[model samples]
Target chain A: MATSSLLLLLADGRFPAGAHAHSGGLEAAVAAGRVTDLVTLEAFLAGRLATAGLVGAAFAAAAHRAVTSAGSAVRGSTLALLDAELDARTAAPALRTVSRRQGRALLRAGRAIWPEASFDDLPSTPGGAHQPLVLGLLCAAAGLSRAETAAVAAHGTVTGAASAAVRLLGLDPYQVQALLVGLASRCDGTAAEAARAADEPPERLPAAAAPLADIHAEAHATWEVRLFAS
Target chain B: MRAYARLVARADGRGGTVLAELRGETPLLLRQTPGSGRAVTVYVVGGAAGPLAGDDLRLEIDVGPGAAVRVHTVAASVALPGRPDVVSRMAVRAVVHDGGALHWLPEQLVAAAGCAHLAESRVELAAGARLTWRDEVICGRYGEAPGGAVVHTRVDYDGRPLLRQSLAVGPGAPGWAGPAVLGGAPATGSLLVVDPSIPHETAAVEGTLARLPLAGGPATLWTATAADAHTLRDHLDVEVEPLLTKVE
Candidate 1:
């Protein structure tokens, strides 16, 4: 029953964090004809999870650990370094913005339930309370391990894609939930890998690979018909 | 020579690559400077902008938590009129800490005749942070006889590969005048914006101005993989709007 509650908490799409408004780049993919069905969508989702999603998870884990170990007052440069790196890799204008929006929403939600993120308590000058930063802060408060923090990051990412799928393919919500459940292990594995490497110095970062995705994102920006915002 | 970026929370340059930390509360302090050193040396600074001479151009930025720093160029970058020397590569990098947002928006790049330039930009996102921006690379003289030009650009984001663009335009290059990368065209430009908050209808978000006018140009947009992440790609086939034509 406890596990079911956690699953429900992670699975509920209507939790009001604004996950319904974004298709990430799937909507643009659909308009551009790059994604037409579930198979391609799955491939795309898997590919992203392995790349951007993996990176996000790793950073979230590191950040969660940073908050707990480095004390509550962390340096701003640490987060900015991650943000810049994320920006450098995000080729699509839509996805970059989408991630921040979701990140922000997550932060907002975190404050109410998990006060460690302390959204209402942060210094107002630092408007850059990005989603991952908030996630890390909240995870610390939740008493979650480093691996669990990474999993949360991965879960949020899948949720973004699954939400987009419902609108793009009109797939049944139950099916999406089931697919998510089945794929949980894969996401967890990714989280574990991310947590394992969370302690690496920022200088020795890995290389990102997503060309078709970037070209599509740029082209999509020039489009005249898109269903989702990003 | 390849330029290596050193990570520093704060760098102050009185006139060049140096900068002073912001003494106030906000972490971000952005300043713009015109062309310097007859070359381009652009970097992020804390609070002020500098000038560009025949040698260098610099930017210093210090982004504090929740603070936003923006460094914009007053005009498009012009690679000196006449040049014949080793590759004049422009390298730019940034160190965005937690709770800090940096927007690097430089004007369009204008590569005139006889210009050999290699531009490189690298960024790393720590975690739970955000970055929104665009970059446009232009080749050839905007308003003069097209000249032989060469551009080799490599852009990377995060730990993955983002963009690897190699373009060579000369009289003898293969398919120089064919319907390929540039569609047998003389002058071409590319724009990339990595922001997710654009609009729900991202495909429809493109405006008429986003297109280039040409009698028979190919214009299209799609999502492809780059640096292990999905990227949106757009192609404007040398076709400028009929009403607004490119004069050379």
Candidate 2:
């Protein structure tokens, strides 16, 4: 399969990876009045792209490197460490649970579509392996490169949240699409940076954090009623 | 140009005591608190005109097994752009051995307007060790716009990464006051607690507004922002000191 087509498939918001249920904390931001308008939404997306987006991309790229690189015997430990590292980078308990749920969902899709042995090596966490780790495994099954995995990770990170913003805030879809178009270059740059660091040790991966987003995720978890899982 | 301080704590049957101490310009003063023989409190005092341009301050702290150490600063250390030729920097490294504990609560770091300062702190903890650390930063003096300040902190527990953060706040920083970043707050305070004994999701948040789970082991990083540095520091202390002192 062509790499771009496979990337397009996985990067699609409707991939059935269960990403639809999550607003990527956008619901919480909207509820908090921080994302009331288009300009603020843009700021939220830009910040998310830099922090969570970059971290997810780096880990996904690193996991892809682990699976694609030589030494098949160490793949198990490498993937396990990647899962734990991603868990550590995620600061919100609710986000951790959401990531694992999303990871399990993606794994179900991967097992059905790819049926690769690399996915079998990923140990199940109390929640599940982080979404990025599972995404990396699925990418390896599709014969995608590390950079492609990073792209998938980075793009999915913002697109899910952007789509969530549309549903929550009822913004103009065309404008949101245009904003995403403007962010395309940033997505490419972030993926490249993540792929470049893919060879680094798992512990040395980038740890970009959004403190407010984390706090919001925690608050979102306790809500009696909400639109997003995280 | 370079100031250094080292503090080594040893378990003395009942509690921990400062075993070896060394200092250059920024000295560490050891104080004894009531009812705790093993617990020692350290105060970082500045010499002369505080931290100036081109000055580098280094602090190394170690807590032995079964020992406890608490550290605080005398007063706010102003980072002045005396020469304007170089940036003032402070680097701190700390370690807690198995079953040891350390509580490091420092006063506000006032980065005066137009000055540039960089502060980095790294902490390592053994499997059974515990640490409660707090840091407060005032971007600039009261009623003034922020200068330039960057704080980078990393914590590792049992050789596993716990938390790592780089906060750059000042003019020209992208969205520094936006809701995604500091949310228009002038001062920011952070509390990092890494301890297994503490129950998960156990945090009492008051005054300040933000709390998040830490990455490594059983830890939580609580952050609060307020109109001024004093209020921010109060928020950090209110939520964190109880947890740290309970280790005794």
Candidate 3:
């Protein structure tokens, strides 16, 4: 399979990764009136992309590097450390559950698409593997490069939230697409930066944090009726 | 100026806890008194002024087995710039032994205008050790913009990585007032509790984060805003007591 086709397949919103159930904290932001218009929605997407997106891409790229750099034998310990590192980066319990839930779904899909030894060695987390960690392992199984893994990581981080914004707030789709188009260049740049750090140790991975998002996730978890799971 | 403070709380062998060692400066004050259920409450008072530029302040605290220590600050610690192109730093290291608990609820640390400050804290805990820690930061004085401040926090329980995060804001920092970041809030507070034995749903929702399950164990993290240090302290007092009492 061509690399571009593989990237499209993974990045597709309909990848059956269980990402649909999560609003990526957009539901909370909407309820709080933080994202009322197209401009606020753009700011939310960009901020999330820059912080959580970059961090996720870095970890995913590192996980992919861990498999490809080792030439065939997947090190369980390295994968385990990567899992722990991602866990450290995430501060909200609700967000971690969302990540693990999506990760389990992705792993289920990956095992069906490409059953490989690297995927077999994924460390067992309490909830499950983080979504990005599992995505990286799937990329390794698909023979995708580190940069592609990061692009997938960064692109998915904000795009899913943008889609959620549309459903939650009934925002104009054309305007949201424009916002996404405007952010495409920066998204690529973030992915490049994350891919460059793929060779760094697990502890050295990017730890960009969004404090408000973590707080919103916490509040959203307590809501009796929320549109998205996260 | 370089200053240091070390506090060690040990079991008095009489069904109570006592301060083993206490040493510091005016910038870091300590007053120990008997508290509820084998715990000693220590009130930390700041001096007339906080650490100036070029001042290195280091604080170390340890809790022995079967001991409980609770530390509270009287007022907020404001970091003032000493000289041009210089930064002030506050380093705190704490440890809790097995079957012990340490709760340090300090007031906000305000970064004065034009001042650069770095506040770093590392907490290491043994198995069965419980900790309820809270820290907050204010951008600057009221009616003023934020300065340069970076808060780095790391925690380990039973030799496992729990949480390691660095929050940077102000000029030239990423996500200054963005919606997904601080949402234009001037003050931010974080409360972390490291104890897995307690039931996860026990944390009452008072402020930002009610119950956040950290990776190392069942920890509660609340990062939100307040009007000032006093208001933030009041918000934390109501939320923190419920979580702190659950350690035993």
Candidate 4:
């Protein structure tokens, strides 16, 4: 598979990874009246991109590096360390569950598509592997570079929430796509930075946090009827 | 200016806690309020003026096995502007040995306008150790825009990472007060409790507050944002009271 085409395929939203079920915290943000329209949605997405996007991308890139560079004997431990570190970075339990659920979903898809991939190396945590780690491992299996893995991770962070915003707020889809286009360069920049930082140790990776989002996610999990899982 | 303060709490063997070692510098003053209880209470009194820019201050705390220590501050520490291009830093490093407990409940930190400040706290816990760590930040003084401020916190339990997060706000940090971050709230804080005795559960979000149990261990983190410090503290106290009482 050509690396560029493979990157596009994995980055596509229809890749059957279970990401569509989660809103990335947009449902709660909308309920709080913090995100009512496209203008506020743009601000929300930007903030999410700068913090969560950057952190997720960095971890995904780092995971990719671990799978590509580490020896087979040490790969499991390295991936476990990455998973634990990422868990530490995620303060909210609901968000953690969502990430792992997505990871489990992605793993199921990866196993069927690339049966020979190193999916066995994923840490067998109670919930499952973290989504970013799974993405990194799958990207590596598809012969994608660290930078491309970061880009996929970064893109998902915003697109998931943006798509949710359209559903939750009934905003114009064209405007939302335009908003995403405006953010394309920033998405690329964040991915590049995340890829560069992937060389650092897992403990030293980006741990940027959004306190409001953490609070929102916890609350969202409690609602009786919510549009998104997280 | 640079200052490093230290405090050590030890079990007295008579079912009480005592300060085994106490040392303070110019601004990071350590004072023990007289009390006869299982937990030795210490108040961090400000002995000097400001932790102005270019100042580096550190506080070290050690809780010996079976000892309990509670730390408090006399008043809020205001990070004032000082020399240009220099950043003010306050670091707190703590360790709790086996069967020990540490309650770090300091006053809010005011990030005064025009100041560049960095506050960091790292706590390590041995097996069976418990901790209640709280950190609050007031963005700026009244009628003033906040300067650059960053708070980094990391907690390790039994030699493994439990929570590691850094929140940056005010100047130089874009979109910090946006919908995804603080969401225009001026006051923000977090309460973390690491006690194995407490049942594992996640609390529902109440207004601007929410509690989440960490996935790796028996720990819960409650985060809140409000229009003012008093309200933020109240929101945190509501969630913290039940757990603390149950643990005690």
Candidate 5:
């Protein structure tokens, strides 16, 4: 499927979509001396996956499920609900803005290349939809398999953390990659968990624990010398 | 610095609602000893409980799941003396069930001249449960220019925190030092809530916050949602207005 290749492309950290600019609050963690080394980074990433990542996975899966309902008039309503729901769930103003920013970035790129009717009608309202949901639908439209969609998400989260840490803490690329390899199983396990529970209701979907990340994100939003975009 | 304290109340959970109802219900008996003391403690030996006083007070809240409790204080906290490292501390422990609402709002604290106060509150939420908490701190006890007081609050929900808000008046803080950020404003307070349904992708939610009418005062909201926690921070800079009117 096209998604397999697309997944490979998106998984690369070199993608010039500006995704490298955000540490997703990890910058604040580093600034506050909360995430100083690789072990702390691992803990932070794990927490995010359970909390924020879980939410992203659910929305992505939901969006992917709805991608095929093109003629179904409920598409608009479903999308609207997903957008609003995600918006409400994201309490940090900075985080919400970042989500929409990344979503727009993905939408811009996906629309220019894919040019599919599905991508054409993507919402434009401020804080419309998260990038993950957008990318999930885009991947689905590109004929990606379920495994590929899950892999893209897992890769993005890990890479986003690693790249942000590299810029924030200036770590050795080899060390970070080793850390990523070590955490690869956790990401895979999380992704597999998401895939298996895809049938569960959205409200009942599991959320991994990660409150410190939220705290840091709020603190980061008010920082004076912020390095990372998020 | 001695924080004046007074509270005599029915420690009974009698009031159905503190905001809407509680008309005919016996007013929570609250009496206190005033002196602006630091180690002020009012044991819940009597009726309803009230908040600790003083501009420099430390409030610690810890709640275990399924604990039904509510707390409030009588007179508005006063910062009579602001120097000599005067402070107050209030630590809360609560573990509310799936259907408990702890409406904790003691009177706001007034920061007198050069008041550096730190207030921290923490709450942990369980699945299918709700926690409604609203509290405000107004700085500038003497109506100085740019309003006064530097208030800092850190509230957490579960292990995943919901709120971490810090406010500084004219100086000593980051935003007030420059022309941007707060725009050299004064007076700020916030109302924050955290519910289930944490966002997966992003952690900041300003959609519901931006819609708030901050009146004509200097105020801003800070919020974030990740995992099981949600946090909203609101601040107000009071001018020549009554301290009680700006809050509540």
Candidate 6:
């Protein structure tokens, strides 16, 4: 498959990566009334993009670099280091579980689709490998560039929450798409930044965080009934 | 101006801890406050005014095996504005040996308007070490707008990464106060506890507060935002006070 077409496929929301089940913390924000309409939703997505989006994209790009640049002998250890560093960046246990759950799902998909890829290099943690690390490996296997991997990661960070906003708030689909379109440049810029920073060591990668989102995620996990898993 | 301070606590073998070495410079004075029991308390008093822009400060804390030390500041350290293009910085490095404990509970750091301050802390914990680290930031004083301030913290447990985060607010940080970040609250603080004895469970959110367990180890992080510093402390204390008592 053409690399560009493959990028589009992996980034698609319809992909069976289990991303469709999580709201990226939008459900909690909506439940708290902190995100009531399109304006607040835009702010939420922008904030998420700047903090969580940036960090996740950076780690993904770094992981891509690890698998592609390192020899097979050291690839597993490098990937494990990246996973541990990303775990450090993610403070919320619920968010961690969600990321690993999604990672497990994505790994299953990657193993079936690209059976010959180096999927076995992923660290076998208690839950699973982090979603970003799995994404980086899969993107690398698909012949995608590091920048493209970061873009895919950054794109999912906002799009998942944006899609959830549509269902949770019942907002206009057109308006939501427009909001995403407005954020496209930012997503690209963040991806580029993340890709550039990927050259650094794992500990030096972006660690930007959204504290309120972490709080919201923990609360959302406890909800008896919710529209999304996180 | 530039200054560096160092403090070392060692187990006295008398069911208590004592300061093995205490040194301070002009703007970073160290004072031992009277306290009883196995833990030693130290107050960080400012000998001179301002960690103003253009000032550089460094602090080193080392806790010997089985030693317990609690460090607190006498008052909030204000990041005052100085010459343009110059930034003030405070870097703290700490190490806790096996079975040692350190409670770093400092006062709020006020980032005054037009000031550029960067505070960074790196903590290393050996096996069986316990830590209670607290940090609070007040964006601005009175009616002024906040300046640029970044609080970066990295904690390592048993030589592995546990928590690493950098929170940048005001000026250069565009969307810091947005709903997903601080939600426009000027007062933000977090308490990090690395105690293996605590049960592993998630805590509920109380208002703008939430306590989360770190994934890599037996650690919990409590974060909160409030309209003001006083309320921020109250919110943090609701969850942190109990944990501190357990440490004692």
True contacts kept of each: 0.06, 0.36, 0.53, 0.77, 0.03, 0.74
Tell how far residue A140 is off in model 2, in angstroms.
2.4
| Native contacts recovered by model 6 | 0.74
What is the DockQ of the complex in model 2?
A: 0.38
lDDT of 6 by residue, B76-132 (tens): 989888878999999999999988999999999998899899999999999789999
Q: Which 10-residue window of candidate 3 chain A scores lowest in summed lDDT?
A: A67-76
Can you list each candidate's DockQ? 0.04, 0.38, 0.47, 0.75, 0.04, 0.72
Task: Encode model 3's per-residue lDDT on A1-230: one tens digit a residue.
Answer: 69889999899899988777777778888887888888888778878887888889998898888777765455677888888878877877677788888899999999988864458677876778888888998988887889999999999988899989889888889888899999999899899999998888777777766787887887887889877888
- Candidate 2 off by > 4 Å: B14-16, B26-37, B48-55, B77-88, B110-117, B143-148, B170-173, B202-215, B244-248
* Model 6 Cα shift for residue B125 (angstroms): 0.4
How would you class the docking of model 2?
Answer: acceptable
**Candidate 4 C-alpha error for residue A96, in Å:** 1.2
lDDT of each: 0.47, 0.79, 0.80, 0.90, 0.49, 0.90
| Error at B204, model 1, angstroms | 12
Clash-forming residue pairs, model 4: none
Candidate 4, B11-104: lDDT as tens digits: 9998888889999988888999976558888999988766799999999999999999889999998888999999999999999999899988
Candidate 4 regions with alpha-carbon error over 4 angstroms: B239-248
| lDDT (10s digit) by residue, model 2, range A97-199 | 8888999999999999987456867865677788898898889888888989999999998899888888998999999999889889988999999999888
> What is the per-residue lDDT of model 6 for residues A122-155, given as tens digits with 9 covering 90 to 100?
9989899999999999999999999999999999
- Model 6 chain A: ten consecutive residues of lowest lDDT: A220-229
- Separately for all candidates shown, the number of backbone clashes (residues 3 or more apart, or on different chains) is 126, 3, 0, 0, 77, 0
Model 1 lDDT at residue A104: 74
Which stretches in model 6 have alpha-carbon errors above 4 Å? B243-246
TM-score of each: 0.48, 0.89, 0.86, 0.95, 0.53, 0.96
TM-score of 3: 0.86
Worst 10 residues of 3 chain B by lDDT: B202-211
Better of 1 and 4 by DockQ: 4
Model 6 misses residue B161 by how many Å? Answer: 1.0
Model 2 per-residue lDDT tens digits across residues B1-248: 77777888888775556555534454333344444656777777776565777778898988999888888787887877766667888899999999888988888888788777888888999998999888777878878776777777878899887877667677534455666666667888688888888777743333336667665688888877778877887777777757755666
